[model samples]
Target: MKNISKFIKIIKTLNFIPVLSVFAISSSCSNKINYNSSTDYENNQNFSDIDERDQVLNIIKKADFVKFDSEDINKIYDNFNYYTKGNASPYIKIKKSLQLFEKYWKIDKNSEPWVINILNKYDGPDITIDAINDEIIINKYDKNKTQEVNNYVEMFGDSIIINKKVCNFGYDKKIKTSEYGFKIISYENDILIPYYIFNTLFLSPNYINLYYDGTKYQLFEKIVNFDNKKFKNFFDCAFPGITPFKEIREDSYNSLKFLMNNYYGLNKYYEYTSWESILDKYRDAMLDINPDNYTGAYFNFFNSLNDLHSNIIIPSLFNYRIKYYQQSNKRKTYAKLDNQLKNRRSLILENSDQNTNFFGYLRNNLFISFDEFTQNMNVKGKDFELKNLFLSSILKLKNHKDVNNIIIDLSTNGGGDLSIMLWIAKLLSKDKEISFYNYNDLNESLIKSTLSESKFSTQYLSKDFIQAKNILKSKQVILLVSNNTFSAANLLTSIVKDYDLGLIIGAKTGGGMASIMPTVLADGTSVAISSNNLFLNKNRTQIEDGIEPDIKLPYDDFYDFRKMEQAINNFQKTK
Candidate 1:
């Protein structure tokens, strides 16, 4: 069923224009045209009078019946059996099912112009196939309708052999697939329908099958149902000159609503309000089906949730319009604070290169600052390079005997790459094991481990334990955080506060501790939501509300190095 669905999705992109008009003119035009009845042959013309091409064309025009050689038909049957393991249907029964698809090739007045306009806009080439007298006639067309016809000698099970050149089906010529998966080649002017994909248009089911008999008729029935539904939906276009349909908008809305109800991590947090009422308010706006209304509804809904990791993406819009919903009040406060901090010239050392300036000494105190934790595994040795850079910084900090205070600044960091965050936590904490909690409605579990026990490709450095214990045991460690410190950064702050590893200063860290899960809706709208893996503190309390600072200071004062140093020293003295 999955393979059949994939096949249907591929065929939906094909340029299935009404080829009857092209065939009639390209063949014998002397034969009079009759639009009322398809079976009316002009003047009761005998088959022996015209050439082989004319006879095949006349048969297509009169009866809508496509003729194919016994061997060619057998090749289809053999491939079908091989792929389905002979479980679909017998050869005789499957042949009967093929007749149901002949009407799909017949001309329709309304669909022809719509399909052709889309094909022309996308620069998709037109193709026609005719099997006649043990050979196949193939016609290829450009956007201007310039046609070229060629006779193909042999047909493989999944491809056509033309002039000893094999054009394999089911695989894109430009975009090749590697062992890992599809590797994108280019996004422009690369629309070519493979033969196997066309075969699926006639063979596979396009809709869900409730009564699965494992027969070919069951599959054929689904294709017929889906085409009928799609044809009706074509008239429900949302905007003029735009191809998106109203049904697509409705489907997108319903699908996203379903996912939010079942899988979103913050469902319990919104228990104060009625979730159904909030969704009902947005439902009508989303279903209105215009571009502005649909996108606006999604934007408003996500903002109401106030989760930073959740958003909607419309790809057809220029540059792929993305809208994120976040805590409005918190963000507004942070924005004003950030502007003020930027204007002041603090005593902290500034460096343009983040990689080279992870750690530095500031008046007998060691400060480590990073915008984000990234492990670029796509680049050859990027992760290894980052690991070595961090190790060198840690070793330097460990050897500095004059350093008494360690300040980890994460004021503007938005967090990324969980494994890298854990690795850094292990290097800065004095304890041998770090502990946190993961909470879903179904279960709540504590996760405690050393860096060596990580499932990801992270290992403890050679002197990580020794260096961390030497510096952390005798000195005070402080964390500087702000509203922008979110996701994994937020989780790190919570861990520091929960385990008494450090003192937090500045404003509260922005809370976005859940892992993100992104999915594409039925209408091709991309949506991301916080997943069920919600982060929690050691007391089994939700960390989504953020962590408060132990020694809070104004944003402007926090930016001044002397003031921050004084606050840290005063807080340690009281302890």
Candidate 2:
């Protein structure tokens, strides 16, 4: 009984999940990439015709190369060790890591050279990062010698200023580091910079020996090799360093356990699974920690949690696991659901005259649908085009005076921007204000928490909203949802239901309400977990378990527009 009590306590305190692993580092840390020594730096003779050779040269010369002395490097190492004490929680460790990165690395100003170098190496667009002037100048190399493009991204304090406007919406001034790189974190969202850029520029020899080396240039070379059809180099780069296998295993296990224990919101709700027992079962098999063994253990652990929002984000591990999933029949449910959603969307497109999959209209009813809230995953900036498209779609629908219905299909949407979702809710609702609450486990204690609510008013100046209101005043609004409708999409569905803005039809939504918190492990592997921000309805009830449909339909009916139309019509007649 005492042992049982101890086991339970362990289970509660150390919320264990399988963490995906990749070759973070191998024993060979000193080996350098053999770049062509003949490559000229002064004249930029190696640069392609498409490259902004002069601009790149000028940027590199202007940007100072920051070098750390031995003492400075030691201090960074000591601080990291002090912050990531064995007793400290993962949240504290992560927070400390961020603070350390910010203190040691003046990334905001000094990051220009590294950014430019990366772009140049990748054969990316001819771009210039002028830190002196505090602007990122992008010029597309057009063969036609078209009018010179002068797109600029500027920096002001911690905010990213673009075109003289502050583009930092969901960003706070705090710098958060991940394995991929670092990001500026806001309470609601984050803008992630590409991986390895930070470490490539800042990591010193001492730091590399004690901590992890990012090996940015080496990784880039591997990517180039892959592009050139040299697959071996790409795969070999996965495990570049000489870090001991045993140490890697231990660090991976401990870090994942710590992260999940403190930050994962669904811990109390999920059935306790003894990760110790699971690990012990795989202990002997995983003694030889190759990619296969490492991946198997971590993959199983992650799979056990059944949490979509939480997972490891190592590049090589992701590549390995994706290949694994492709070959294996495991997790077939997700695959099937993905295929079903694709088929349904394809069917809708086939039936409708919509040029794009984003939105359409049929039989005087305006249908708005998009799979993700983001316009472009690569561009970490405001998407004016997406916003314009959404607004124009509403206006187009409203222009049809005979139309008396608006149908929003979110069955296939995996979710994206929270702000966009709220905006959609505000546009459709009759109420002047829409309110939702969030419960955040700020202390990482999982007990004492903070409850906060956000209230959005229908104050948008878009003329489309006026038209939207007119349409809402007369037309029936219907929301189509399914088990696949997740994250922001699910949240949108919940708002529509709670506010009585529309009649919801289809199936229960896939719930993923918590904002994602990304952090790096001790091994330098990046991972994201479902944060402590548990979303709540108007009554303060948790919406993480998913919102049930007002009128559930057969799964097949979601794909059949005719059936959906018939159902909506019948429901209206009954009303």
Candidate 3:
């Protein structure tokens, strides 16, 4: 089995997923991006007017973005080596190459965006990458043959070097971070195809000199493998030129502050710890480190985040947050909860009515195992009528007289699409009410806009789900959850608990309640922060501790059939 532990499923999501390809950016990195209503971040801004858009546009347009063809890139490499001759050392090349890559790649940190790239051989707009592997499927709703590719990719600290390269690497991750950094291929005539895109825009960006490091020579370059032509740039410096320490420090501080203010839900978990205090601790820690040590200072800042998602990849930086990044190789279980999760499949009851089935599982008691909030293939936004399988399955159970309770297994699930969550919530509600209000960090305009739109993206419609009724006329629900239940899944659990729609039967969910917002550092590095603290209602039903269960059943090796029966029976007595 692949050694992937998801409890610490830290991610780099802009809206929610950050491991995605930077495919939506424009061709040129230097040209300023015009931030419009469409730059999705899970939530949208109510942006007072077009002026707000213009204001953002004016700020970002200062940068000139450009694209370098393969020939241009090859020429630059040739010229640099020719000029340096035998005199240049690898150290010199390293520094010079960085500058050259920065200039030519137009890697303006404030504007680069990462998006899911789908190179479909058939027709249709590509499916966005909200989550990878689990939620992402190729041509999910299409009738085309699987597009062939050399099932090949090289992984770097930040970006994946696919056969369809975005640009030549100065180091490795630089090409992917630049405005011309990501690519996708669309196949029409059966042969493999290639296409590329980059997002070139930013607004109210606090630009900084991120590459300026005082202890420049201390940079560990061994981790990177430079080709022969590129290797000449790494010159052994006879004249050591260290970047000023103050420069890196100032950049780090300014960028950190801007991120804190923009993260809409940064204060939502203040009860857990204050963002200000956390920032202070890290900022203070930076002082204790060697002032010239930008790497250490930057690592410390990254390590101090309350957001696990923030623990994603930073270019040239490996697993500095080892506590969070390291995944367990062994698939063994230790805790009682772990045992329950391990044995969850065996413990579930087989449906009495085999006719009621969903995604292969027999929905006897109307069990829908929503492993992820992924959309079905051929499923379009708000087009629930086409991909409303879960709803139809639940409604199928309603026709049966014996079905009185439902079980939704959200165990081992990481969140996916917001629309999936909303649609499900709408279907489960008996009173035709919204399950919860979602918002983005610091953007009050977005909260108001979300209130107005009542949907996350402009792609959704209230009408699609308006027809959704209580799939269960009056049946109770038993949610099977654990620490794995997170993000949009956590929101669903809370709604179930808040609305008294179900009895949470397992461990408490891992609350990833706030909207995950990705912000770029001055170095063009991006990571996601839990920016919005949303609520189901006025009670501010908590998202952090996750939804509490009515019957807190610890996991057991053998399925606790008696306990389940007792809990269900006990609930029926009360009802």
Candidate 4:
């Protein structure tokens, strides 16, 4: 399950694509690719591919299996005797239960009506992964008294003997016991398959992935691991296309230095030009720096990007105060423009209470006012109430002869789940599927994505679309835009424009079409990277470039209802 914005508050709080469900439970995005929906594993024997390690494991399975079930536990212990014998496989499958979690970052830049925020998702509790191969004997037994995972160093030999290095007294600690566990993977609609993300955090899942292959489960892909050897553990791409920032493990000070060198880890492009100089100032003095100093340094680093889509987020539970830094003058100007727009919005909608409804009408202009992409809507999870609210509004406007024009106002909307986009699209067109594709730079394929998909996503979306068969067809649509319109919200405008559903009006949107994911530092600090690149087509040439209004409105006249009123009338006349 994948939603690249897995580790930051700025992107996290902005109600983004609810996917992979921490291995997310949410669903649906683009075209007819059946994609890896989570439900495929809703009943999976967890994340173990025992079939691949049969040669290495002497475990047993029941007809219906839960990886950590008591019977499964008993069988592993029953076979533990064999595992101890020389004849048994060389690996010790650590029979332990643990739950892993992935976090998210949100796009909170210095702008009006947009605040800095981060969202967190845990992979759930008491979840464990299985280590079935001799490779497990090689990879497991994290030393440091189980505090830190040690890296595997290959011994130069005819058969390539490998050994784990001694970092301190911790290296002496080892796993004497054997048992069973299971792996859980996260997938995203932005990405088709879950990529291997290997680090100290995950040394084994980095090596293999299991797939359905149309019929039965099989070893879909095998990835090679790379040794970062910075701290104690190795950093490698566990997920094929998405890898975490491994250099951060080298030194606490090296986090920004490493990321600046590889900013694409969470983004497609690097915006900072002073990287060499910035690194020169901060790289060598890491050991002496305080946490607040480190926080300031990272904050300044992100501030330099001047990118609304990206930011440096400190974990909320960790509750570290990020030392505030002043925004660049260029950033200040952008923020000012947004303030003006908000003021103008106030003047135009003065008569209407702004907070009550997500959709409404003012005179002949039917307005769909959606401000954010969070799941905490009228109701929770399914978005059923929000759907009905929007659908009902559209239906009412369609019947009202006075409503000859439509204004889909997404000015303050910061985008949440992709399904919400499709649900809105369902009301606009008869074509149910929001057909599109993406290119993952790491995977280098249009068909693949940064995260794995789940059946749950596909099934739920398919059902949601099916239920909304009739739409407000052929109505003249005019979309309102602003600089804050972003991510999935930005995508909504792009989709509407791509399908010729409407005319865009206002400023160009924030262009952050890439799906981003997080990687953690040795200190448990998390930073993110744009693990996947998104494109609008199979050729991978075009992407969801920020939307430019077909009819650009003047900045000063944003508050002037006459401008929008005239545009709506002019739009209707042309229709």
Candidate 4 deviant stretches above 4 angstroms: 1-250, 254-278, 285-287, 315-319, 322-338, 351-357, 376-384, 448-471, 533-539, 542-545, 559-561, 568-575
- The candidate with the higher lDDT, 3 or 4, is 4
Which lDDT value does model 2 have at 397?
59
Tens digits of per-residue lDDT for model 4, 1-575: 12221111012222222222111100111111133632221223232433432332233221111122233321221211111111111122121111111211121123112111111121100111222221111121122223222212111110111111212111111111121111211111110001111221232122122211111111211221111121111111111221122222223344344334432423334434334576556544333334554455555665666555445433211223343556645356556765666556655666333342346677666776656654345321234356555656766753687766677777766566554554455446444334344433322222311111223333334333334334345566778887767767776777677667778887887655654444443333444444333434212234345678777776665535568778656755877
Sequence-dependent TM-score of model 2 = 0.57
Rank by lDDT (best first): 2, 1, 4, 3
lDDT of 1 by residue, 361-440 (tens): 76777776665665431122134344555555556765687777778878866676565665566656664445554443
Ranking by TM-score: 2, 1, 4, 3
Q: Tens digit of lDDT per residue, candidate 3, span 47-84?
A: 33323311211111111222234444212122111111
Weakest 10 consecutive residues of candidate 3 by summed lDDT? 191-200
Which lDDT values do the candidates have, in the order given?
0.43, 0.43, 0.37, 0.38
Residue range 1-575, candidate 2, lDDT tens digits: 00000000001001112222121223233433224421121122323332232122111111111123334421212221111111111111222223334433222333333232112211112233332332333223223322222122111111111111111111111112332112222111111121222222222100221122322211111001122322334334433333325534554555555455544656545643334554565555443456565655555665666776666544232133233342123235645775777676666666332222455577677777666665432112223355555567676754577776678878777776554555566557664345554443322111111111122111223455546555576667888887778778887787888778889999888787666554544444444556544555655566777899877788877656678778877877887
Positional deviation of residue 430's Cα in model 1 after best superposition, in angstroms = 1.3
